[model samples]
Target: MSTFSLDTATVLAAGDASEHRVLIISLFVAFVLATLGITIWAGRQTKDATDFYAGGRSFTGFQNGLAISGDYMSAASFLGIAGAIALFGYDGFLYSIGFLVAWLIALLLVAEPLRNSGRFTMGDVLAFRMRQRPVRTAAGVSTIVVSIFYLLAQMAGAGALVALLLGISSEAGKIAIVILVGIVMILYVAIGGMKGTTWVQMIKAVLLIAGTLLITALVMFKFNWNISSLLGAAAENSGKGAAFLEPGLKYGVDSMTKIDFISLGLALVLGTAGLPHILIRFYTVPTARVARKSVNWAIGIIGGFYLMTIALGFGAAALLKQETIIESNAAGNTAAPLLAQEIGGGAGSAGGAILLAIISAVAFATILAVVAGLTLASSSSFAHDLYVNVIRKGNASEKEEVRAARWSTVGIGGAAIFLGVFARDLNVAFLVALAFAVAASANLPTILYSLFWKRFTTQGALWSIYGGLASSVLLVLFSPVVSGAPSAMFPGVDFQWFPLSNPGLISIPLGFLLGWVGTLVSKEQPNIDKYAELEVRSLTGTHAH
Candidate 1:
């Protein structure tokens, strides 16, 4: 193992940055071209709505599982979580735990049932036992909202990650990167659809897991394979001493922070099952058994990856100065890449350039794959759920619906680019946690009620979805995330009053309560026959498409 020195790791000056820029740029270009070529190939085979929306249910269990990992493991996991751990220590590792453990919820509660019930979107499942138009509209609205929030995290991550690699620190430069990423993401969805997107995600997952493992192994090797030694070095390098190993660096500070941690935990744990992109991934497989198998595979892959994050996060702390990491990107999104640079051979060395380029290329792949998935999810919701069912009243041709989805991708991509410029300063992982909170609040309760509650009515679905959606969004709008703090999206203002950064604590329960109460107050009786059929379809897959 190469000896790691703080002096060597911290010397990536302008001269060295310029040296590494060409290699990094080349890798990024190669990755984009390769993925784009795959998309074009997949697009040629996409001959129908089924192909565009669900990849014609063509992927196997292991294949879909790989794609799921690709879709789920965002820059938030690779860049955001590593930065969090490198800076905040124990509190930051909590993100990985929350994200990995979330799959249990998806596996046990959602995967099989969702696959058995839904044809193309979450709207299909929720509208199964309710008034089709109203429920589909609500579900479509919720899907798009949740999806856009998730996309912002990807955009923010891409901007920060790419900005660091290119040595661009200006606001305008980062904004330009965001727009470029958005444009490329739109092309991925518009051209490749689900088939192309899935293939990209699958390839990205392998690269990410392999890249992370390399860093993790090197990190462990640096400390002579001693876990205690690695932690001690990290703590010493962080200048926080023993406190770094304990809680409260960022999250467990006091009563309010502890409560915020709980809210964040709730969002992370409950959010995965309700996430539109993840939920729709379940429909890409051929059977409910395959869906369950895919979740099983994802759990193994994601869980192992999270376990490695312990090393990647702490490794950065052990190797690089806190100030250096903070200076590169205040939110610490660049920690993993810097860590790779150090472990390979810091700064002006040839080894450093190659490793940094590889890790960064993998990270860029993560951002592109995730943004494409989120765009497809939102656009699919609009075209399949809102446009066809609501506006066209199911009279539109398949070709028209698919065409509308392609156009929707362009609009959504533009919106993400505009908002991403403003959110460029926040931590990508934290932003994703907020997206999770919204999904858990708005989508989870309604999904659960529709699946298991026989008494669930159309009013209850709307109240649960819309009420939860509006409340979580409104709370976030006034929360510290958007205003009232130096780290907020709008730092100059001070309008925040909400205590928790994540609204999951209050909004999740509120969604469930509204669903229950709305069911009780509704005059329309529950459709027992439809519920029975849905229940059977969900449980046994007797007649599931």
Candidate 2:
């Protein structure tokens, strides 16, 4: 799932792809070498738990904003969405809208308060006004679960992408790529820590945006810079013709599909705020105001990038043949690259190879940056929340905690690699949707209750996290994602009884209800004094740790 745009081995293995292969490999190596150099440099500066987990809380708003943009834009958004748009027209833009709108929740409500209250992880903010051990433990567990789901998705995608880029057809070669990605990401966290990860993310963000803007400009140029002409050409080129420009071609306007679309929307909009890796970005900045500023910068950058996806997607549809896109990758993930290949000057041309190489390289860099952030967040939760507070009763030294974090990086990375190799054939986008459902259900409700509701108890926080997690997992297991339909991971097994694929429609409400019920039924009184302090600090950043 390692933020890959396409499972392109089949594409590379297609007719006369030797030139494209060499160009992709050469550029990928150059980018990897440059990123490895940065990781080595950041390793020397990461000395303490604070430095490792939060980049010493020193990054400026704009810098962190760039990092956030890098982390948020995944291969799914870049490759998958663009491909979807190329194939399905307007239907693909829904994903872009969901991703961009999610940041609004983060910027307006979550960023400032999270920065004011949290010290290391989301658990810090959750356990801020509650019983320390139980609340922290629940938050830690939820964080790890969500992070692992995302990590596996990213790693699996990485394996597929690497196999394609390197033209490796064997399972062994794919596994090697998975392990290579795992090792690099583990080192990114264990060595460079957050500072290194942040720098990598910032660099990747710039390159990704530049590449996207360039391709978009190229797309418009193909149509003589006339918006209507591009639209008309795309509509005419798409096999669906007028139907392609309309919604419901891919997702459908049926009742069940409509509900599924709404559920997916809910998860995406709420999930970004709850994502541990994204939330941890706030800790990298120095103050609540800075966090707010970073998020604003992120929204602007992300919004523009998504808008460009329109040009990329439509450009692909207009310029390339649908049969050709399907031949390259049934998932349409290779649409952007193929589009680049054609727009640059067709397959064997120097310009085509160069443009295709740039896109592939940026895609790889995007994966590396994102996985490093995920590894750091998961490891931080393990060491800071579970090992320090729960196991050691908060008595562990800073050095011990940092050491534990580094070791946990290895553990988490290994698990991710193992899962990625096994799940390489799974749908990366579907897996990510599941992760979002879990995060939105498990983490978002707890954060909102913890930060805004005075009556929220430790028991309530625990209920919210566990309830959300359990329901999402259970629903996903029974849903079409795991069992029913030809696309399901286990299509032969028909245990799916749930009507919808996404669990957010059911699980998110259950989480909020459980929190309310757990709080009302509690015999213990609310901690008014602690709530007063948390309320003041969350709102005004007064006397914050």
Candidate 3:
């Protein structure tokens, strides 16, 4: 079940690797301290609800753009997608395509309207034209569920990535790393608030882009800047010949596999627009125009980064043996770092150690920044939508609401840590794909309907949120990811009956269907006046919060 094979005694016994371990540890410690300092600095500027939840709406387009990229280019992007390409060949690059194309949906449909309509969380926009209590409650629940799923992937990635680099092969070591990540993320959300978290994300984004750029350059140099050469070598080294460079190696093998590929594609492409953490990021900017710019910048930056992943993935496949990559981490989460080590100068070289340390630190920073954003989004929903808007009927003071959000951060962080330990062996990309499916299913329907549909009612919002949430999670519970397969979280169990590992194809349409049905059947009438006001506000930022 463990991806890491280096235990404490083993590290001590391997005298040469000890130096590499020391270097990695030092870089990790430095990144952590540097990010903490940034958080502490930003925390002082966080004074009230607006500051805590939305960074006082102070960031410019490019700045918030980096933060958004930081949040989006997570372990799934860096580790998971790269690993998928390394292991599955052409099928894996599909993730890169899906993820990059996802931003178009965000830019065209989500970013501006969301920024103009909502003050803080997604619940704000969803509840704008509906019964506040019921809609806010449902939106809050949906947000937390989606955010937690996303958080679990980041935490699981953190555990596997860190343990793989530090040479801690024990299960306990991985669990401990998860706990440490949760604790750090809690501090980022609770103390630094949105401002601190944004700053950390921005810094992490720069580091991640730099690290990836360096590796990509090295990879291209190794292949003499020829894409053809790299692909040929990868195909040869993958042990599957030309098949490795083509489809069906991973997702095109059977009817079920094809459907699963489509499901995963739907999740990755449609999921970005609905992701709670990514949604909340728009609030950090000043205006709807700025939000659009943020998305544009993010698209360019993220697109470039993913394009580099082609080199990273293929380079790893070309250089490292498939069996060794699997032995490093069956999910291939460690392939990026191993590639860095190799390109720097194989295994025992000083250059390899330095490069590994740098790359691992960048990835660790990626994990920390993403988990912070997710924790912030879920906790903000718990406090802003559920506690303040629903339970207190908007009677709570800003200070009290902020306190509730901090507490919620601690609670959600703990849950993520607990869940991450169980999920450490799972593919981070696959786990995140589930989160995307849930978000697309539960949140996206309500959001699009609320913004564009004149007949969208409170009942429709409720049905879409709850129905989508329930079906997605339930389907995943019975899917191959949780049981009935060798890679299942519980490999010994076999209760899975769902065919697709990802629920996007089924759940996403169901969410949209349920919303339309609920609206038609409900007695509650749609509010024309509120819808008009919402439209004006969403389109022009007229009297927006």
Candidate 4:
């Protein structure tokens, strides 16, 4: 007989490894079955490209709002941010707040006008006033780039979840998640189209909010419902508590980190309004007004969701105990789940175990819903903008376009999966920041200038998109991901070479400058008057005719 002496920590750590694999597999299988069922149901309604791309433009503001929330509150928002807050304290909360505040930009500036002007993609908004082929082509390329980056981040989160929950190798876990997400998302796009994706997002959004709320409540109950005591205890237990409440000098307090935080905040806030995948969701609504209302609704829900994360973070800190967190890789990401198990008195405890199970399951579902939305956005850009406009000169049949979109979804999903598998050990939070930088740089400048600037021309748009894309990508590659310097990716690199991990501060201005320069260099085309008038009416609801 083998005998093992178990310390309290070891016993706690080893508490119920028996049913974890079974629970994970069962939850995953349930997710697969539900997603497949939705796809099969949605397949029956998909009759043409428009139906597939925009759900026949029939969703209510509330339904679309929920879907938008689902798309926005991804795995990064759920697991990553919670983990960050648990680990870093106040800085993580800053990220959550920054992300939520960006929707204000959407509600006030982009939402109504975006839906009023575009049909399938942001290319439609750009092409509405410029050379159709060039603008659409540029927009398509930008969409693919941004979407792929976003997809990679989401897939990385999914793989990490599987590995953490199931105790599998990251590579193997990534493969399983990729195949599951890719196959499920492809089917949703190919068959159910926009309707299917929207419904999935809606359902998942509800599940996510409920799951998080339940965990938060339970966590508070375990901490005796005393907020001050909880905070004090957490702080006493971990030296990180003081820094966690007040943003660090690097992220929030220090001058240099403050500048970086502000820049990152700007990128996240503005970038949400300009993200191609997110913008496309407006077209799923029945009218521009509905799109406007949808943004308002999304703001409320998303805001509430972020608020709850504060309690969740505190719960992790107060109940999970500091020693357990340090032993579990020093990353706060595991704090919440670990807390759940401990409070439940091990995995054998029915209540805590079930709650943990549900939270993990919801995290997986969150990834699927968000990735499906992204895949649809990227695929539509390829099929409707690139294939139909550039390759076929807008003469392709609806069926042909729909087929192309379906195939493109599969391709993009597969590419994201491959990248996630290869980079399984990489930090996804950084990838998400990169996505925001690209969106802020490439897409936001073009969208904002086109909507508000009367002098904006095709030349300016082209310059802004390409210049922003190039600058952001180059800055990231050289910053840390590629160069193993000192900090996270490049910890030892000279500070002069890369002062900040995020490039939005420098690159966003460069994008604007390039756009202005391009406009000055090119004489205003004769078509500017007509296009500007159309855009004005679209914004103000005045018909020039």
- The best candidate by TM-score is 2
Off by over 4 Å in 2: 1-17
How far residue 496's Cα lies from its native spot in candidate 3, in Å, is 1.5
Candidates in order have lDDT scores of 0.84, 0.85, 0.85, 0.74
lDDT of 2 by residue, 1-545 (tens): 21223344442333345677787787778877788789889889888888999999999999999999999897767888888889889888788888888999998889999888888899999887889999989999999998898888778777777787776878888888889889988988898889999999999999999999999999999889998888789989987888888889867868898888888888889888899999999999888888889999999999999999999989999999999888777768888888888899987788888888888788888888888889999999999999999999999999999999999999999999988888887665456777788899989999999889999998898888999999999998888877877767677889999988888999999989999999999886888888888889989988765
Better of 1 and 3 by TM-score: 3
lDDT of 4: 0.74
The alpha-carbon deviation from the true structure for residue 485 of candidate 3, after best TM-score superposition, in angstroms, is 1.4
Candidate 2: global Cα-lDDT? 0.85
**Pairs with steric clashes in candidate 2:** 1-153, 1-154, 1-155, 1-156, 1-157, 2-154, 2-155, 2-158
TM-score of each: 0.93, 0.97, 0.94, 0.91
After superposition, the stretches of candidate 4 with alpha carbons farther than 4 Å from their true spots are 1-17, 163-167, 170-177, 240-244, 249-254, 329-331, 346-348, 485-496, 524-526, 541-545
TM-score of 4: 0.91
Superposed Cα deviation of residue 133, candidate 4 (Å): 1.6
For residues 1-545, write the lDDT of model 3, one tens digit per residue. 01112111211221245668788788889988988998999889889999999999999999999999998887556876777889998988888888888999999998999999999999999989899999999988888887886777678767766776677778888789878878999999999999999999999999999999999999999999999999999999999999998889888888889988888788878888999999999999888888998999999999999899899999999999998878766767667878888898877888888887787678778879989999999999999999999999999999999999999999988899888888776644445556788889989999999999989999898899898888888898899877898877678989999978888899999999999999999998899999999999999999989
**Alpha-carbon deviation at 150 in model 3, angstroms:** 2.0
Q: List runs of model 1 lying over 4 Å from the truth.
A: 1-15, 167-176, 421-431
Error of 2 at 391 (Å): 0.6
